[model samples]
Target: MLQELVLDVRKALESSRPQRQADSSFDRIKSSFACQFSSVNPRAFLPWGFVRHRTSKWIWTNEVTQPGGDAPIGARAFRKDFTPPLGKTPAQADIIMTVDNGLTLYVNGGQVGTGGDFRFAEHFCVALRPCLNVFAVTGLNAGVPLACLPPSKSHTPTAPPPLSFPTPLGAIPLRWTPAIAQGAYGVAPWGQITIPSTTPVLSLTAANWIWTSEVVNGNAPAGARYFRRTYYPPTGQTVTSATVIIVADDAYSLTVNGVPVGSGTDFHIAQTYTVNLAPAPYVVFAVVATNGGTVNNPAGLLVAVEIMSQCNCISGAYFISDGSWKFNTGTSVGFELPGFDDSKWPAAVIEGP
Candidate 1:
């Protein structure tokens, strides 16, 4: 019969090899064919309903504008490599990325990250095995508005002049102890001092002030140096309104007693410089800082001088002679409260509501 049918097919393939090695529990089955058969590098296996078509077009806004406008999409000239091809390293593989609404993320080109505006619709992800990675993206709309698309034209309407604060304003009680040129407001020179402005004063000095510097043993002078101070507003006060701000985190330069009104090198944060004074009773506000001198470490300078009034109290209050009340001096700085009544204060409270 053909040698008994080859010995019954070799005993039925040895009884199916121990029932396929006792079913091997499907190797803890995590589907996708267990990462496409546990990838021994079959091109790192990626096929199980595979359908990837990642396309990035860039150049959105033929004109219908307003969805997140800032204008300027794709190729504003920025793409030094746009890398993304490394499997296993952000600790050991598994990466993700998403972008769709006015993106802005660069890696080799610099940036690093940024979100979208107006509603939502823009995603991001990071974690690419540690090295060998580059990404590029850029898109803007600038504040959209081109009249419902049609080629794209209309764009020329500058209007930003509505920030008035006029009154017979007066509020001074800014203190910072240590500078006593002669004691009781005479000699002065320890750090922080401001109290001498009273007249018809429209906006003389009550925006607050605090500055500190030290290096008395090494002969000072290491990097920053600029100062000024002059004030006289009393004769029917007339600064109308002025603003010179600073939160200083690094560099500085400002003047008034001798001119030069504004100068900043890298000083971060509260920055608002606007000065057009002619109705002077006595206006002099100067600030020269380099507290980060001896190689930068914890120097100081926190300044503010905003004045714009025409009456007495258009609802103002930021007290701290002990009563405690605050609205904004950066959270009443260590305890003198009395601010928080500028008509309920909350334009996002200052810049973001």
Candidate 2:
């Protein structure tokens, strides 16, 4: 297969420039890497629900955040191991690949290519080894939401067999899979590596991190900052479930309609909670964020709330810690109640993501 790839490229160079071809395989490639989104050029990618071969799907590690999910910035390792057909090694093979933010690609432990801007795909050509071949990638997600499309395929002029594959994000400390991050399913990150313990809830992606105006340059007044936000159930309907994630710089205590829900201290790891509101026509979410320190220091709050209304489970209401929430520097014991008057309070400040 590698030999055929080499001959294919060699013949193309020997002859006039080979026109780029677009077939089922190429169409799949374009759908994933041609642009940052299929919406950018509808004709450049496959339509939604288009059945595709399982051999190709986007994959990532469990640690890699999906679009809108936040995490400590870092990189994860992935590998694809395969043995090409026995024959004289190919002189060269051309492959194309792309990622959401950036990637450093390696083959047999050697760096081959790197791409940062996901808006455009990249092309790479390298010599193939006669024995076992390994394709490894170092995927870097600078911030929220990241994933790598499955790497490119190698084709021989005479034999068009694909040469490399299996890409997905793992939920574990490490993960590997063949085309695991299919775009249709909210595109799970990092292949099959699912570490639910570390996975941030999906709804958080639609929310934001927020705090009071006292927070400046990520440093807030060294004291308590009160926050409250309200949500109303659909007219003539009630809500049955609400899921919320809260993270504060130092500590936080969350409440729903004046009832205690949950709390957390370490801001590095977000805490999630579910509250029942089966009979309520409206709801209020409250939090007391404490930036514990003698002087000003880094402090902020991030909360993501989601609820499914009884009228239509498909219709959801989301509330993030944002400017819509009111804040008070002083304490108020019953601030979380649905009838609490917060109209005079200032809106919460928006800290950086």
Candidate 3:
């Protein structure tokens, strides 16, 4: 019995390396954490769990309320997902199930057990992943006149940590945890961002056209260049709206917090664009400008931005494209993201206003 238990654990413990989980994947490494599993019983491990007798309802493709009902003699696939809370620790899930004809159980994409008898219920002690976990079942009926049964009886497991898996067998494309029901600040599922009936229009000024080098002093190599300027609201103040004028020597695309807004091509004409960072803590402006000229041709970018958190944007504070902006040649992965590090990139050079 002990040997069997060890084998089960070994099988459960065996899992492919976890894929990257989103939302907080690239968050600065503040610290690391892992679940300290108790030396005793079942927990979210991998592909292993214990099985016992527990009754559950059978799911029929054709409304087989009775075992003798005219449900087709074929296989039906059922899936549900459970997600644990986002925390440093792991969690355990105890499950109970029964099947009329035959059923195979897959957890988080791995087979756990199979049952052929509806008389003896199959109880499962499942360990959950830190992220989403899926429970998939395939049931088959051989046109038998027995009582119908599904896989597990829907029940919330006891928690040293926590368990909140909902069984929605018919729902495909399952996810382990509940969806992030909220959008950005002042967005839907939370509340609407209050836009004042009389919103003040902001303008751009006092910032020079800048790039890797000054036009008269140096020339930028052909191809593309990246530039970024980030703004933070004063402590306790939230940004309501913002505006900027962007211009480049050739062509450019601009994004605020990874959302693309507009672009400009002619350096002689700077396009005014509105930025809505309602209740903003901070915002980043990313620009990728391509100079279609040859290697020795000059390229430059000019931007002037005004952010309003207060009635008059903290008394007219403007961030412009200048030496404070970070710059890099060609393309760098994740450069558009707010958390991306540009500390190693050199500062942009001031060209002309």
lDDT of 2 by residue, 104-189 (tens): 66655556556554433343444444334456666565674655444323211123212232222111122233322424222344
- Tens-digit per-residue lDDT, 146-240, candidate 3: 22222322211122111222222223423222211111222212122111112434333555778875345467677888998877654334666
lDDT (Cα, tens digit) per residue for candidate 1, span 1-353 = 00000000000111111212223545423321233223221212222221121221112232324332344322111122211222321211111121223334443223533433212112222222122333333333334310111111111213321111000011111321111111111111111222112221222123332332333332333455333333333222244545656644356666553456665656545556766655555455545455455653543345545444222111001100000111222322212111212333222111101
Global fold similarity of model 3 (TM-score): 0.41
Better-scoring candidate (TM-score), 1 or 3: 3
Off by over 4 Å in 3: 1-205, 213-217, 278-280, 310-316
lDDT of each: 0.29, 0.54, 0.52
- Model 2's lDDT to the true fold? 0.54
TM-score winner between 2 and 3, please give it.
2
Question: What is the full ranking by TM-score, best candidate first?
Answer: 2, 3, 1
Give the top-scoring candidate (TM-score). 2
TM-score of each: 0.20, 0.44, 0.41
TM-score of 1: 0.20
Ranking by lDDT: 2, 3, 1
